[model samples]
Target: MRVENLHCSKRINPLVNFLIVALILSPSLTIILIPISFLLIMVYNVIRFKLLEPSVTRDTHEKFLQFIGGEPYYMDLDTYGKKGGTYADAVAIDAHNLYVLHEDNAVEIPWSMVRSWTIQAPGADRVVGVGMTAAMTAASHNIEAAAKAHEASGLFVFVADVNHPKWQFRTADTTILRKWNEILTQRNEGLLAA
Candidate 1:
């Protein structure tokens, strides 16, 4: 798929632009107009995102199918953190290779080249608390740490390639990460046995 076809341009609401112009001319109504402007922008953004989601998903699936001919054993569209001007990203597993669709291109990594894979939770040092009893502090810190980990967990795939040794796909949904990890482990074990 051509990368140029995936570029999307979002047009700002003309009413919002008009409202901003009004606010600039009528400075007396700044207090009332500011909140209304903010709310309208928020609503517009939510609606726009909801409408675009399905098309984005469909395009990602089509891209995957075009790139990987056979039916994928496992496919996930929620993967992220690949940043080479790609519109969407997904990870798929087949019998012989692991496929990553990103940057409007598909990359196939043979099972043998996958050295290791793991679901890495965010570090505990991300959250810090202050001015409490040691036990309370510890408890709060642990709770915050767990929450952060759950929110920012990612799957790390270590490949044998020298230039691109590690691939990280970040997602808040740990279930998918765990599932990928299990599938990869099984594939590695099977490769070893063969």
Candidate 2:
């Protein structure tokens, strides 16, 4: 079963049409209007995704559950895509495997093939200065630290699969990271027992 979470065509068509009409009707204004229109679109998307469309995540989760035929041991519904877009991507763990669900495809990796996993806070390694005074350096360091603290965290998994060795999923909510750590600990303990 294939699940498509992105409706890019539906969203893009109207925007494209609007741009075309603007160019035809007022070519002189097109240059000015284009940037304004794009800025408005960006703001609208931020509002829609961050506030209005949380249901999209739930809906994607439901569809994935249907595809997998049961509840997963662990699942994160809110995850960013590979290129930092939100296409309702998800990461899940069943009894025997880990699953990465993208908009068009799904990858299943056996539990035995998961070499390791870590929760990585984004922007943690960002460098603040090339050459600056101590005061400036300290201030930059503080700002960078603050930014890192607020940035989305990601789950990075190292797998043995040749084709797809690494999988990463980013989420703004830190609770998801904690839950994933717990699940991984339990799974690891089970594996050691067996």
Candidate 3:
């Protein structure tokens, strides 16, 4: 006599089943998942870092740095030619305000007080800035974006001094961003790996 079939289909985990369903329903789920995963990893890493290296990032002041966002950053009156000068202990954001804390102050800047930033000397002395006027001036002077003038249209600087123009800043395309997402993805992986 012939034997009857007895094998059953393999079981799948409910957790995985839900994920499949959701992914199928919304392809964008993958996009959302990546950042969320990275954020979670970052949070975990930060917590781990705090535990492992307390001195490296003690409080927000020691760990936090000021960097600008966006592309084609402007050079302004407050931040122009602030480089090649002394470093500043107190970084002035505008005419009335200054940021000197290795930590953030409780008082929030109202945006009106902002003026510009500065750069400092190599030994971390002196001060300078990249003001709006400076950016406009740079642009107007060359008939090109400041980024192109210094071959830095992709980046912006924030000076450590009002007189000097070495302001703190970030670039639209840092060395890592040149290759686009591939570079960034690799960078993110590297950061996580570190």
* Residue 64, model 1, lDDT: 77
Candidate 3 regions with alpha-carbon error over 4 angstroms: 1-58, 61-100, 103-107, 124-194
Q: How accurate is candidate 2 locally (lDDT)?
A: 0.61
- The per-prediction CA RMSD against the true structure, in angstroms, equals 8.5, 8.2, 26.4
Candidates sorted by TM-score, descending order? Answer: 1, 2, 3
Q: By the TM-score metric, which is better: model 1 or model 3?
A: 1
Q: Number of clashing residue pairs in every model?
A: 0, 0, 56
Q: Against the hidden reference, what TM-scores do the models get? A: 0.62, 0.60, 0.17
Per residue, candidate 1 scores C-alpha lDDT tens digits across 1-194 of 11122232233456765765576467686555655654564465456556655666677787677667878888887522121112455678877778765444456778778888878665555434453444445655675675466445667778888777776555656687788788777777775232
Error (Å) of candidate 3 at residue 52 is: 9.8
TM-score of 1: 0.62
Best by TM-score: 1
Candidate 1's displacement at residue 73, Å, is 1.6
Better of 2 and 3 by lDDT: 2
- Candidate 2's C-alpha runs over 4 A off are 1-14, 17-39, 47-55, 79-86, 123-153, 191-194
User: Candidate 2, TM-score vs. the true structure?
Assistant: 0.60
> What is candidate 3's lDDT per residue for 69-179, written digit by digit as tens?
111111111112112111111121322222222112212122233343222222112223366545434433443333243233222233333443332322233332233
